[model samples]
Target: MQDCHILITRPEPENTLSCERIVTHGWTAVPLPMLDIAPIEDAQQRAAIRSQIFDIDTFQYVIFVSKNAARLAADWLDTCWPMLPVGVHWIGIGQGTTQALLEAGIPAISNPGHTTEALLEWLKPAKMKDQKILIIRGLGGRPELGDKLEERGAKVHYLSLYERKKPHYTAQTFFMLPDIHLIWVTSGEGLHHLSEYATQHKPEWKTLPILTPSSRVNQQAKEMGWIHASCADGADDNSLIKATEFHIGKQHD
Candidate 1:
């Protein structure tokens, strides 16, 4: 069987697991990271964490918006609180985030699908009126969740634990991409990173086929002149693999 290659543009955890799943299903995975998430640059954020560590008990719910957020928050929790606070519920924004928290020893977690809308839907059942919710997330994310929580009478505290910045596309990311048969883009930001790189350095991608995770990303790809483009349902590895298989199979047929 001829090996197939698929490009991954998501951050870690998702990137890592997506590679594992695609390879397990007998495909070659190429990771050209579009974003690098690191700790928030603000010193005051760290200082606030230190100052509020002991008050973990005051929060009725602690929500992690991504695996990156979950990992950073868990590390900070170990250094700050050290012990798990009683009656504090944990909410993970996606399946991957929930698994990350569970692996980190947080047993009580509410995991919705990977969007603010899904998180809100999951929270609807809990009906946490007047509860204090602390959201540990990355910098400059969508504020819809927090705003809705506040509107629903929940006291919301949003903390930025990390920041997502575009990673430099090394020669490896560009030179090695020609052999890649498929590209799996999870978000518009990830696609924007690729488009920006192509615009500055490699103009060949204007003709390339792209497999995006949503119609939004597909539209973005089309706007960027990617004539051959398709969309998966989401960033989930399974969904990505299915998309790849469908495209590859169609080409073969």
Candidate 2:
């Protein structure tokens, strides 16, 4: 295990944590952040976010799509709302997001699973007619959540608090790809970037095992001609570590 190297492609702060966890498990962790998270700093957008934070109680449900969404929304809510209003349900899409919300003092936050589809299934049985749901996330994501909520007779609002941009990698970065034993792609965008980089600069590395957090990314990797693409149960750190270990064990077998 100590001889194994796992390439982590998550963004900073998160990448640091993931790398530390891998090291704790007696594996070498190499960080190459594929996406950079930037906050929305436009005056108009900030004003709109402030308005939503002030009127947080109006929405019956507040949904956080990722850990980034939970952290950014919690920052605004902590600033604008002296105290979180009671009776409003908080929904986190996964364990990581749920833990972030809980740490922000949001009580009783619910997380159905790691994927949006799972969350939708868990929410389908709830009464949504005339209910208002606010979704906080990065800019330009899937519309399925809002669309499904609308179909259930719920009004949906979005607070695009951050943007995810592909990071510029130098030639040295791609040179290290051939040495990486395993790659971990947490998001679809990360997988796309990795595929693009590998195709352009390190095509031989495409055969290396890739562990993803979702089926969507796994499919994308396979379509890109990656021979070994495996998916974990969720995006949480524990799931990712287990998946990485399993893939490494299989490689030895």
Candidate 3:
């Protein structure tokens, strides 16, 4: 555990949290963000999301699909509403998203299961008919959550707040071998970029352990020829820490 350097590929703030936790364990945290988060550059789209945020009080419920959405949406909400509108329910897909909401002064319902199916299952008890539900997310994701809600006769709206883009970098931008003991990426896109960066730095280092947030990402890592692809099962801090410790221990063993 001593002197271990974990390569964190998540974006700012989130990666910063990982760094704080890792250093406490006497491990070095190396942040090399692969994806950059930003507001939608299209003026019309940006205006639409902002308009929705302004009219947030009209919605019966607001569901944030990811931490990025929760963070961005919270900022907009903070600016738009001095006092959060009552009678509006807030929900987050995972503990991380819920934590982000809480940090932004929004008390959101959270669950251990971070997937869309899990969210749908949890909402089974509620009567979704005639409910105005707003979904906050980044660009280009599975439509399952929105689709299911709409199918249940709930009016679903998407307030895509940001875009996850790759950061252009040079070979000199990364630390390899001795400095990076393991790689941890929450998204498959991050894992893909990690592979490219690692290969560019030192192709042989692909043998190093890489942890993913889900089984889908683990499978993708394996397909990309990663030998030590490990799934963390969840995206929350505790899940990530436990998975990191388990994988790092397994590697040492």
Please write out the lDDT profile of model 1 over residues 117-136, one tens digit for every residue: 76787787447788999888
TM-score, per-candidate, Cα-based: 0.84, 0.95, 0.89
Q: Please give the CA lDDT of all the candidate structures.
A: 0.78, 0.86, 0.83
Using TM-score as the measure, the top candidate is 2
Best by lDDT: 2
- Pairs that collide, model 1: none
Tell me the deviation in Å of residue 7 in model 3: 0.6
Candidate 2 residue runs with Cα over 4 Å from true position: 176-178
Count of clashes in candidate 2: 0
Clashing pairs in 3: none
The lowest-lDDT stretch of 10 consecutive residues in candidate 3 is: 171-180
Candidate 2 local lDDT, 18-132, one digit each (tens): 9999888888888988889998999998998899889889989999998889888889988988888988999898888899899988874664668888888888645988899
* Residue 79 in candidate 1, Cα distance off native in Å: 1.9
Candidate 1 lDDT score relative to the true structure: 0.78
Model 2 pairs whose backbones collide: none
